[model samples]
Target: MPKSLVNYRVRHAFLVSYLLIVCTAAVLGASQLQTDPGSITVRFIIFGVIALILMVVGAIMGAVSKKRSASDIGEWNYRKSLLSIREYEKVLGRHEEDFKVFYDDTSSAGGCCCTISAAYLLYLALGIIPEGGIDASFWFTPAATLFIIIGYALLGLTSYGIGQHSVTFGVGDFFVAPDYRGLKHAKMLEDEEALYVKSLVKIGTQDDLQALFETEWRVYLDGQPDTVYIQLKVDKAHIYDYPYLVGIIVNGPDVVERTENLDIDTRFPGIVEYMSDEGVSVLVSRFDIPSDSAELEHEPNITAQEFRKLAKALARRLIKLSTE
Candidate 1:
């Protein structure tokens, strides 16, 4: 079958299963109600309606929840919006603002409570509110309703928080900025926009890379915070010549270098190939290192292994400098 057909079938199956379970629970609750002499018809009707509404809403929310992207700016905006709503609620109570606090609170809670409440109510409607007694069933209804309300309220607040964090522009946001340094020179050659790649490079003679490694040991150290640094070099040869010298520098001074027996030349070819496959453009010479301060301004995405090696190198350098 086609991929789309498979996906449709999967979704259809899920929907059918969900509906079956819900209908079964409803039937069971109704049966229990029929047997119970003291059951109020009006109460069951009200609970059933509420439960149905919660389930529909919760399911819809759940389906859409994956589309929500969490970002720093979005989170900040949501918090601000929620706080504004809360402040308005405090000032006006139920009637103070055009936006209702109950609605706000409900949306903030998210879909979990709505789902749970609906399921609980469906069970109650089926009269399976658990035969432990009235006390057990009585608490269940209110608890389920409360959970639904709280869940939706959280969801609304979180959604709003995320919205607030998105990048906003008024007047000064520019698509292109002038490069005071030679950073933009690399991009100009390829007729492409500027893209940055960051990795640390060890400075010294060929033997310095090996010396740096011997000074640093590979061990999990505590009470030390992990730090990531992005280094830019104008020279590509510096990268090729050092082998895993950059990795050694980042690992820290105490890390032992095992370059003698290992082939660093071939191992990094895979990384280069991977980057090339990923469409990453490179434009740097052999060995010239860029200024640290200038490189620090631009954040570049680095691979996990690259980051670890760079971090270890920095730690080693820090240790050596401190001792000196």
Candidate 2:
């Protein structure tokens, strides 16, 4: 049989055993009450209620196990193994805080489940003792209680094992933050707010390159706090009317001399209005070249050498901005 089916069967069997034991105990207790006219009716009532509770709990747990199994199978069928690591990293990055919460919650749940299940198993075992036989027997009650506690501890560990595997396979918990701090930090030149420039070489189609740019920008933007100002200086690269390389300079709120795009000069007012509506102090300018040719000479294509230079410049700028 398949692994999922096997797991389902095992869980079902455990629950069935638990329910059967409780039901059998209830039946035996009820029988004893009928025979002995002096028997305590309260004892029978208490046992019956306890048994019913266990049966219900077991049934609910069984349902949850089955549902989890089905989800695992579906994910197994749909998921690709090659990208598993990348996906895991992506999840960690995007939902760092959420993952922490999930880990803590599941661990606590596992511990409680183990402890409670053990206690119930002990209760069932102790029920086997005749009421009048040995009222003060220390051996059976203590031993049974110990065994139940240990058994549930082991069961909880098993549950955790199942959860870990399920999460790894993209089956169990999928909780994570929508925007991860890692991506933001990756693009960051320094810890403080300041201006930074980064350039991307685009050898592919404009659409493909643009997609990459958007992905990077979105991740960075999402990581920032709402109070920060973000500005983007865009340098468009064109090859036969098709845009290629795009250089970007990101500046924070303190930057002076507002940059303008010649191509869409008229659109700036609308863009500013949109940003205001969205509660973001950010703007993306079109490719702009000044009449003075000295600026072009200074801001040349960003090579590996240029990147190092920019990193240092960004660091210095951040220091100045923070101190100010």
TM-score of each: 0.23, 0.26
> Ten residues in a row with the worst lDDT in model 2?
204-213
Candidate 1 global lDDT: 0.31
- Per-residue lDDT, model 1, residue 137, is 52
Give residue 51's lDDT in candidate 2 (0 to 100).
47
Query: What Cα-based lDDT does every candidate model obtain?
Result: 0.31, 0.34
Q: How accurate is candidate 2 locally (lDDT)?
A: 0.34
Cα error of candidate 2 at position 10, Å: 21
> Can you write out model 1's per-residue Cα lDDT over 214-296, one digit (the tens) per residue?
01112222233222122222222322212122211233233232222221222122221101112222111111123343554
**Backbone collisions counted per model:** 60, 3
User: In model 2, how large is the Cα lDDT of residue 314?
Assistant: 30
Off by over 4 Å in 1: 1-37, 54-119, 122-130, 133-270, 273-324
Model 1 deviation from native, Cα RMSD in Å = 21.4
